[model samples]
Target: MTYRRAAIPALIGGLLLAALLWWAGSSADALRLPGSVGTLGPDAVAELQRWVAPWAYDPPSFLDAGVQGHGYVLLGDDGRDRYNGIYTAGLQIRYGAVFAAFVLGALLLIRRLPPVRGRTTAAFLALWAWGAAAGTLAAAVSAPWFIAAAGHGSHRFLPQLASVTAAGRQLPVAVSLVAAGATVLVARIAAEGASTPPRTEVPARAARLAATAGTAVIALSVVVLSYQPVAAALQAYSPDGGLLAEPGDLLRQWLLLGAWDAPAAGAVVDWLLHRASDVLLLAVVWWALSRLPGLLTRVTLPAMAAGAVGATVLGLLASQLLRIAVVQTGPQQGLLYSSAAIGNGIPAALTCGLLAGVVATAVLRLSLRGAPEPAA
Candidate 1:
């Protein structure tokens, strides 16, 4: 039951999960071009060249045309269809593996720790570490697929080719870290024994209110910033010679600027505004459950599930409102166009909020469940 003993199972679970993710990710698509230019007609090759021309980083040339032609041969209509199927399947496998691994790892680790005060923190830390470790391993093992998919020709087409590749490669790693964090939260809550006494309700309520207020402020700010004129003004005054020339361009520029200046204090504020609701949803779920012990204890799973749904609904509503606001205040045509980006609309916000709420509920339950009864 010691940390040392518990770590063995954790390590094994992490390794197994990592291996599964790597296998799924790598095998999701054929890594190489499917065919060669020799198999295609000259006219077909010329059309393919035109299709990929915009993506080319260098001056248009016969060599570039050939390379692009080869790429299309590999990823023609059939290849595209196959890639989609494989990618979807891979995603399911990866998510399932992450979810199952976290639940199993959390239960295993929870049992090993002494049932004492502060064990929740310990459990959270353990789960977080395990998730991160597993994710890192999966990312490392899955590198071959991404590298092969990028191919030599991709470099010639994209100016920030290396950065793009790195970002692609890091997708699994980010997913793993997030999965781990959520698992820890859920496990922490579940580990709290059924009969354990509840803490004072006042503080939980207060915290929830404060979190709600904070979230509201940030969401409003984001909506305001998304207002086309406001966004244009911000971009114009920004240090990096604002790039918000066109209507839909503000959102893209904001995102790029945020990424480029992430280390800066201002960027941190932007990040918070972008993810305010998700960040605050933890407090909302925790307090809501605290106020309703029956929901927290008897229907724990259902409550968490509901929280996820609620988060999604709230996110969508917020997004819709923002869209309406943008349209009312800005140009009509590009009003809803930028909603596809993260922090700009419903999908990303809903996803982030749902995950956070579910995880927070789980961890809060474990934390509340106190020490296990001693055996005779």
Candidate 2:
């Protein structure tokens, strides 16, 4: 089968699987997981209620269920819904779209590979297992983002999430993982027996050198662009805000814009806009990186993924240094927010990197198929 013929079908099937996964994940209350902070008590529960009361009508169900119940609480919480009628569908769509992006990434990688002759059932099972494994890691690493989003206004959101959700976080994660795996399986079936086109060749040495340099550039760009948010979040936590006064209190602040005092509608809009911008920027960076010599080679998908993740980690380290610089410049900068934002953004970098690599490689190979090689 031609690449185009297979890709379109594969993408369609993959998206259907992604939608199914999102639906299942969003419908259940106990699917989302919190970190391993042990448990909670009455005081902890009350604190959680106060922080989440602005947006969530039922703080207990919302926090206890983690991401799973966020939609229901905001939209389906009867008249107690406290979202001020500004954010219901948008919130739900944004959350589910994240999981769908995971599915799309898996499909991109699978489509790049040559099809194999195997029973459809067996292919589905194998692909599903692999996808589930990936989903589990994504869910685990992204716990901080979800936890913070739920209870960002509160200083104790993380612990409260862990306490309220108890052990229920595992179930939603498992179900979402299972759904994620299905997306992979469907993509594989759709692309069965497909063949790849000839690709443009570059000198191996040149390719390696170029990829290395490109990766470094990507890392630096992330650090520089991210400094503003990091600085803003830190400044928001200063004495000027009357939020915290001691360096010891910095870790308690959620790494988000100080939207606690903003109107619920405005806060939700700002947060979503920030999220969309980050994703768009990362995608653009990855797309450009994938086009660098040899980075998107068929056999190098794993390397591309690893490189993307490594760059994100390196950028996070640089951001920490930047934060330290700001602290050294002023005695009253306080401890500010933790490096949670960078840590939370890793999964996005990984998936987007893979998807970009696959797409760039495909486009280049297809475009150059019948062109004459440059005379060397």
Against the reference, the lDDT scores of all candidates come to: 0.37, 0.38
Model 1 Cα RMSD, Å?
A: 14.4
Candidate 2 global CA lDDT score: 0.38
Shift of residue 199 alpha carbon in model 1, Å: 4.6
Q: Which stretches of candidate 1 lie over 4 Å from their true place?
A: 1-17, 31-201, 233-376
**Residue pairs of candidate 2 with colliding backbone atoms:** 31-172, 33-169
- The candidate maximizing TM-score is 2
User: Candidate 1's residue-wise lDDT over 1-376, tens digit each?
Assistant: 3334334444444554455444534532222234534565444444434322222222223223332223444445554544444334434444445445444544454444322354444444444433533332232233333333333323332222222222222233334444444444544344445444232232353334433433343343344444445655654542322322222332332222111113356567645454454334333433333332222223244333333323333333443344344323455323223322222232223333335445544554454456442221
Question: What are the C-alpha RMSDs, in order, of all predicted structures?
Answer: 14.4, 14.4
TM-score against native, each model: 0.33, 0.38
